[model samples]
Target: MTTTHQERPLAVLVGVQLPGVDDVEHAADLAELGRLVQTLGFDVIATVSQRRGALAAAAVLGEGKLKELAELTGGSGVVPSGAPERKNKARARRAAESGEDDEDDALGGDDDEGDADGAGSRGARRATVVAVDHDISPSQARNLERATGAQVLDRAGVIIEIFHRHARSREAKLEVEIARLNYVAPRLRETGGGGDRQRGGIGGKGAGESALELDRRKIRDRIAELKQELAAIQREQSTRRALRQGQRRVALVGYTNAGKSSLMRALTGSEVLVADKLFATLDTTVRALHPEVRPRILISDTVGFIKKLPHDLVASFRSTLDEALEASLLLYVADASDPTFRDQLGVTRSVLSEIGASEVPSRLLLNKVDRLSEDERDALRLEFPEATLLSAKIPADVAALRESLIAHFEASMVEAELLLPYAKQSLIGEIYENARVLSEEYGDDGGRLAVRAHPAALDRLRSLLAR
Candidate 1:
């Protein structure tokens, strides 16, 4: 019963190409899992994929490959040099993957799997493993781990681990805890408490404390406490949002790790951590965009969106995402570098619609344009005529984005001609500093004042005229 995992576990990332899934979809699946393994401190040595026209219920990938992986034991629980003899032959097959292959194997008992390289040579054996496709059920993981003799992790666990690492704020940490607890609850049941055997009680108790029940109870209590604490934080967040009412707020929303924080930092000159990892940011950060015209345009850069984003995590972040909903504008950022940008766009759009933020006037921000050439940028300009394409790393691109935002003001802003009395001419000064006054001409009745303002502020000015 080994508790520690091998230092360099040989990994094979799996993705099954099923019907209705495009090639890029499957590629993203593989790429995301690779990133997840990196976060979990696992070395991905190889990849194993299959195009399953239909799933095989008995063994997910098919019986033949399942049996092959089963026999290898993924180099687990045994060392190659001390192995009995049969297990050493596969060394040549995986030579390319063994970057630092010392003769020493990480696992114990070389005799467990085999010995020598078929000619009685000696070296400890290492573990070659498999991380299977997204949506692998708990039963599926156990089945694969048993058949392949390799520990298993699905997409959700990978995502949860990334969230677990990135959550900085207390609220975010609790939200992640709640999601993790929920994720582990069903998994613990699926694995049957890791084959814990029941023991007889000294007092002749009818039922001893079962491992499964204890794990389940602990998860349930932790989830309850996390939820309670989250609720309290949500209350505080709600109040903070309420205090900023009436300002034209905009929220930058998009797929996870889609450079939202980078763009936010680029625009506001704020020190938001910009990382090259998925879900690098989990907390919401808001800043005022302009000091004049709009006076205060509160723009929030919240957590990035993701495909197959868990509903439980969504519900937990609803209070945080409410900031996006209350916003007057939505800035949808997309990774221009991703070949499947269209699909990513569709997924984010679906999430927005689900969150009830679909109706807001959203302008797409095609980010990472620095990765593209001039011709490529021009090509995308035609693809998204309405969106702004910019690279957060480039200051010039940030300036272009700012100019594009100001252009939005031109369409929504209203121009008004006002007749001000001589005594009320001082009121015009207030409007001059706060707004762009086009003209001032004295007429027979009074002085004329012409000004341009955004719709909301224009309506407020109209009300002031009545006074």
Candidate 2:
């Protein structure tokens, strides 16, 4: 069989700082965008950033910035050999001026602008893609693409692309596709004159829709089908969750690449996929917490949150994030070494609230403490005295976190002694299954047992006892 190799495209990262935005945060966003592009197998060639009072309506960037972007892509105002024809140059220039391009160059030709500064210097390869660090309207995206003569991917587009690549499980794949279709359906455009197709001679009775409209309709149909499939998957998930209803559940939640999977492995001894890449773990993994207590504690690590996560993605993952809703406790893990961890925490909180998990009891986990200096650790401790500071890689820290989880569960448990009858012996199995049976006694007609379990479990057992 013949094999095909994909080439990594060179990308130019772009960001704009609006009025009242902090310079540091904007820069961090751009840096994160670069990382995102790298995750998608792109080589970041340069970054374009600007500060503006307001974004331009047509192109997200100003006129001067658009020219800079065009120079990076078009190369010294001269079309390279094998580039688009002279007749199309005006259209490309107009698109570039408006910050749009005709099609992507994911594996396009060699560049003549490989200069380090991306200034289209001699012999330098032109950037193949422009990755914008902020969400741009569809019109603006088109305009930027036209002006730059390169593919223009705004922040949401980049994120959705990453999700598409990272999704592995069936549910995850379905969710990603649904989100992607929703995002792309509106951005679909008809290229050239083929969009002028018509049908029967009636005003509205004809199939007068263009190929673009047909494509959008197909996308809509596919999204609906995916949603139905996802709903069925979610129902199966709900059934599985129902099976573990009585057990205490703790969900590990936080920003992307925040050591959650590491902590899950440390606490549960399960080989959860751990990588430095953002969104490395898209599928939720559930495992039993180690040093397993009676009525085992189940820990789940979910897809992490990020700044400006696409709304469609969040809506699509609502079923997955429902784990947080079912959780008895939520461990909000964060990278202690990251200066922007606070903002990351805020993003997680906002998402949780949106998903109706705000009422769930949660604890802040300032993880990766090993990466922080003594002063930084102390400063964090002072800043949030109630937050738990620990490194997931350390056994002791994991043990401490485990114990804290156990304590929380134990505190919610109620103690009770019940004299179970032999005739009702079947109830004994349920009590054993749902509670911590501390003591048992056997008598002629029955057995007496002392158990500690959540009040709900006790009430459930008591109902069976009375019946």
Candidate 3:
């Protein structure tokens, strides 16, 4: 089961630590970026980072750091300005001398010293992708690609690609497609022979569009079509949501890989896809809370959030995230074992605020506490006294969380008494279904019920009784 570099594309992570950014935060961002790259199936061999007042306009990294980054990828570390043919010839000669014919090998430099950190040796595989931990401009990406002689992807690009791969539902697929197209639209570059224009107009007399323009147009058209399809799917989703208006819903929202899905499965007893990779769960999954209490509660797991989550993805996944916006309560789950859990929690809150879910009632859930030491758990309790600190893997912890959920909804419930006539005895079953029946008595006339439930549910029960 030996895996070669070719089996998993090698990647070198690059990050620029801008002013006003904490050192630890910047390091965490790069680490998270590495995870994101890994989620895209790339093997991260090395990381390159530098503290700068701002990212370099041309390549997002300084000359020295860029060169250091290039060493890992066997690149020249200089963007070509002109005479591309000469550089291509030199690269080709190097490939021929090395007995390599792959396009990746063609990008290697004359230096065979291998990776900067000695991870790779002479004639060993080099990184073929450079993943930058920021949203770089199109020109910046182009310059970086030329300097490193490897494919470059910025933070947004990486996240979009993960979503594009993980999307499962029809709505999620449509949303990811739209976001991917939007991201690709700006970075579309003219390939070889792309300068030629397509003929159009009467008698084909005029040049209509270049290849790049045609590709951009096609992307734009596809995005529009995807949007229409997404809207249709959203309408259907709305209908489903409307049907559940009377049911209490709790949405699990948190940072990616934060054990939200684990908690989801624990609470709902549903077989949700839980993975350690970032963005592993893109589609929203809903199921009834298990153990089936009266006035059943429904739990939904949403797509996770991350620092600098792309705007296009936020917009695209709005319908899916609306599960949180429309939920009766939100469980803000965080991996308490993670040292950066506080910062991750902030990211989750910021994204929820962006979507107007800030006003929703939420409870902080410090999950994965099983991995925390006793002292660490005590410290967390002192820091977040209001949060429920528990692990999704523990049955007792899950039962406590379930009870907490039930209590949260119960606090808002209204107690009501309903009387059913003999002629409407069939409605008694509906009453028991929609409300928590504290007492029921069968009288000669029919039945009398004492129940507690949401006001809306009570109203519906009354209307059914009246009918």
Cα lDDT, all candidates: 0.69, 0.82, 0.84
Q: Which runs of model 3 end up more than 4 angstroms from their true locations?
A: 1-6, 82-115, 201-207, 419-430, 439-448, 463-467
Give the per-residue Cα lDDT of candidate 3 at 100. Answer: 56
Q: Residue 291 lDDT in model 1?
A: 27
- lDDT per residue for candidate 2 within 1-467, as digits (tens), equals 99998757788887777657786787778789989999988888776666654455667665556666677787333233343322345545765786752332111113313433444442566788899988888877877777778888998999999999999999999999999998898888888875776673643323878877767777877888998999999999999987777678999999999999999999988988999898999988999888787877899999999999999999999988999999989999999889898899999999999999999999999999998789988998899999999998888888888888898999999899888999998887788877999999999969989999998778778887989
Instruction: Please list the residue runs of candidate 1 whose C-alpha ends up more than 4 Å from where it truly belongs after superposition.
Output: 1-10, 67-129, 189-211, 290-294, 410-467
Q: How close is candidate 3 to the true structure, as a TM-score?
A: 0.87
**Model 1 C-alpha lDDT per residue in residues 404-442, reported as the tens digit of each score:** 777766677678887777766667755654457788899
Q: Sorted on lDDT, highest at the top, how do the candidates line up?
A: 3, 2, 1
Pick the winner on lDDT between candidates 2 and 3.
Answer: 3
Candidate 1 lowest-lDDT run of ten: 100-109
Cα RMSD for predicted model 1: 10.4
- N/CA/C clash count, model 2: 23
The top-ranked prediction according to lDDT is 3
Task: Estimate the TM-score for candidate 1.
Answer: 0.73
